[model samples]
Target: MNCEKIKESVSIRTVLESFNLLPAKENRKTAFYFALDREEKIPSLSVDFVKNKAFDFGTGKSYDVISIVQQINKCSVSDALKYLHKFDLSVLEKESVAEIDYSKNYEIIQVGNVRHPALVQYLKSRKVFEQRHLVKELVYRFNGRKFFGIGFLNDSGGYEIRNKYTKICLGQKDVTWIKNGCNTNNEVIIFEGFFDYLTYRMIEKEENSIPDHLILNSTAMLFKVKDKLKVYHKISLFFDNDHNGRDTKKMIQDDHDNVEDCSLLYIDFKDLNEWFCNFIEKL
Candidate 1:
C-alpha cells in the first residue's frame, strides 16, 4: 500500500468516518479545531489548537504536513498520494465478509476440537483454501487437536501454513507465549511463536515445567498486550532482537510499568523456530 497518497487524501476524520468511530466530527472546521482529524494526539498539538503549525506528538516527535499525513493514513510519505488515489472505499466500507463471531451461542461448525466457522469465512473471502484441502492438511499437522480459529489472511504475505488444531490467522511478526503450569510455582518463560511452544513442550516434557507464555503475535500487538504482562511475578522474555523484534522488546519496556529479564538468544536468527530448526540440523 502506497502510504503517502493515502495520507494526503485521507485524514484522521476520514479514517474515523470510514470506521464509524465514536465522537464524530461533522465539519472540516470542527475536525481541525477539535483536532479530531489528527491521528496521534500528542500533548503539543492537542494543547495548542490555535497555531496548528509544527505538530509534535509529545514524545519528542515532530512531523510536518507530509509526515503527519503518513502517520494518520498509515502509509509511507512517498506512497501516500498513490495509495489514496487507488483506495477502494466500497471494498473497505463493506462489512468484512470474513467476520468471525466466536460466540459459543452462534452456529459454528466444529470438527473434533477445532472451530472452523470464522476461519473458513476468512479464507473464503481471501480466496486461499477452496474447500477443505488446507483445513485437512492443518488438521493432520496438528494431530487433530482442537483449536479456536481466530482470523486468517489467505494473501501470500505471510502465515500460509495452518492445521486443524491450530488457529491460523494473519498474526503479527512474533508471538510471546507466557508459559505457566499449576505444578510450578510463580515463574514465567516468554517465547516467540507457537512453534516455540512446541519446542518448550518437547524440551521440558519430562518435568512438564509450565511457565506463563506471552506471545506478542507481532511487534505491534506487543505494545497493545504489554499491560497483561505487569501482573506476572517473574518474566523471562525470549525474543529475536532483529529490527522489528528489537522494537517489540523496547516497546514492552517503555510501555509497561514493570520490568523483566528479556533474552535475545533468538537474535542470532530471525525467530525461535529458525533456531530450533538449526539445532535439529546440527543433531
Candidate 2:
C-alpha cells in the first residue's frame, strides 16, 4: 500500500496499540500517550481518533499515521508503509471507531509495610529484601476486583506498582527523587525504574555516603526534569542497555557536561536488576 492510502486507511490508535503503546488517558474524542520519541511522566502525545493523527505537545511535533510509525520505529517512509500494509481495512475501520477505556480507576484498600510472603519473596528474588522498607504493600480494588502488589511511591503521590505478573502505575506517573539528607550534595544518580534504584541501594548498603537518587520511572519524564538536573555538578545515569535507554543517556550527555553513563557496569544485561540477579546467582 502507498503511504497516502495507508494514512487514509489506518487509525493512529491501531498503530500505537500494534506497538503495545496504550494511552495513559483517554476520553471519547482524544487520547494521550507518552511521547513516541521519549519517556515522560505525563502522556503528552495527543491522539485524535477522528483526525487519525497525533501531536506531541512536548516537542510540538505532529504525526500522521505513516509518520507516527516512522517516528516510533525509527524507520523510513517505505518501511513504515510496509508495516502498515499488514493491517486489514476491516481492522482499521473497527479500530478507528473503537472505544478504548484506559481508565485505571481504583480505590486504595490498604497501604502498609511490605510483609506479604509473596511480596517478600518477590523482593528476595530481586535481591532487595533488605530494602523492602523503601516500598509499601498496596491493596487496591479495580473493576470490583481486589489486587495487591509492592508499591513504590513517587514524588507525585503515585505508586509504581509491581508484582510477579504486573507492572503499572497506581497514581499520577512521576519521577521519584530521593535526597541523601544532605543539602550540599551536588551529585545525583538517575535510574530508569524503582527496582534499579533499589538494586543500587542493595549494592551500596555499606557506603557511609551516597549521592542523591532520581528515578525517572519512565524516560518520557526526562524532559520534565532536564532543566532541574542542571543544578547538580555530577549526574550518573544507570539506564537500561536497550535503544531507548541509550537514547535517553545520550540526551543527558548532550545537555550536561558532567553526566556519566553507568550502564557499562551491566553492559551484558538488559538492566541493573538483571545484572544484580545474575551476580547473586554466582555467589
Candidate 3:
C-alpha cells in the first residue's frame, strides 16, 4: 500500500482526539498541523501530517496516519480507517479496525527462571552456528534449535560432530536418518527440536534403535517436511501438542500412510523437554 493513500484513509482528527490533542474549538473549517522542526513542542505527541507526520512522542517513532490509528486502536490499517466512522457520529467519519488478539509468547518448556546455558553452548559447539557460518541460528532453546542453512554442509566435522557422513547438522536443522537392519524392518519416528535429540541421545547414547527418524526444527516447518516423507514406506510423526503442533499433526495426516501422531504419549506440556522435566523421570 502506498503511504500517501494510507494517510488519506485515516482521520487525523480521531487520532488527535484519542491522545487528547484535538483542537480547542470544534470548527470543521479549522486545519491541524505540527512543526517538524520543533520535536519538543509538538503537542508532546500529535498526529503530524506531511513534514512531521504522525508520531508517538513517547517512542520517538513516526508512522503514516493509517499506521498511527492501527497502533492505538489495535487493528490493521485498512480496518482502522473504516472504524473511524463510528468514533464521532456528528462527523461523516467512517472506518473499521480489525480486532487482533495480542498475546505474549510464553515459554512452553522451562529449564529454569533463566534460559538454559546448554542451549546456547550447544549452538556454539556447532560450526554451522559460528559467526562465519552462513547458517543463521534462530531460536536455540532447551527444547529445540532452528537453523537457516545456505546449503547442506558436506561431510565436514566442522558442522556436525556426530553423523558427519549423513550430511546432517544435528542441532542446526531438521534431520532425517534412515538405515537398514535385521528382518528388513522399517520404522519412522519424529522429534521436535535438537535438544530433544540430545535428550534422546542422553538416554540412548550410541544405542539409538528407531530404524529411521526425522527431527522437525519447529512445528511451523512441518508442512515443508511432509513432501520429503512421501518417499518413505512408513512414517510416524512425533510433534508437540501445543496449538501449532496440533496444527502440524493435522497437516501430516492428510496423505501419509502408517502415520502415528505421538502427542498423546506425553501431554503434560508443549513438547519433549517439558514432558521430560515434569513427567518422564526414568532418564
Best by TM-score: 2
lDDT for model 1 comes to 0.43
**Per-residue CA lDDT of candidate 2, range 1-283, in tens?**
5667678777677677667777788875799999888878988999998988889899999999889888878899988887876554744334223142212567889999987766775798799999998999999876565667899998889888887655677778799988887746588999999999999988875545567899999998998899999889999999999999999999999999988889999999999999999999888
**Cα lDDT of model 1 by residue, 187-259, tens digit:** 5565554444444444455446566655444445565556667666666666665776667667666755444
> Which is the better candidate, 1 or 2, if ranked by lDDT?
2
RMSD to truth, every model: 19.7, 18.1, 18.3
Worst 10 residues of 1 by lDDT: 137-146
Ranking by TM-score: 2, 1, 3
- List residue ranges in candidate 3 displaced over 4 A: 1-183, 203-209, 280-283
The 10-residue segment of model 3 with minimum total lDDT is 94-103
Residues 1-283 of candidate 3: C-alpha lDDT, one tens digit per residue: 3446545644465455445444422222343334233444434444443342555456686666566567666788668666553333322111111121111211222112212232232333332222223222222121232211122221221122121111223232334343435313466566765545444443444544445656665565566666767766666666777777777777777777777776675777676555654443344
TM-scores for candidates 1 onward, in order: 0.38, 0.63, 0.36
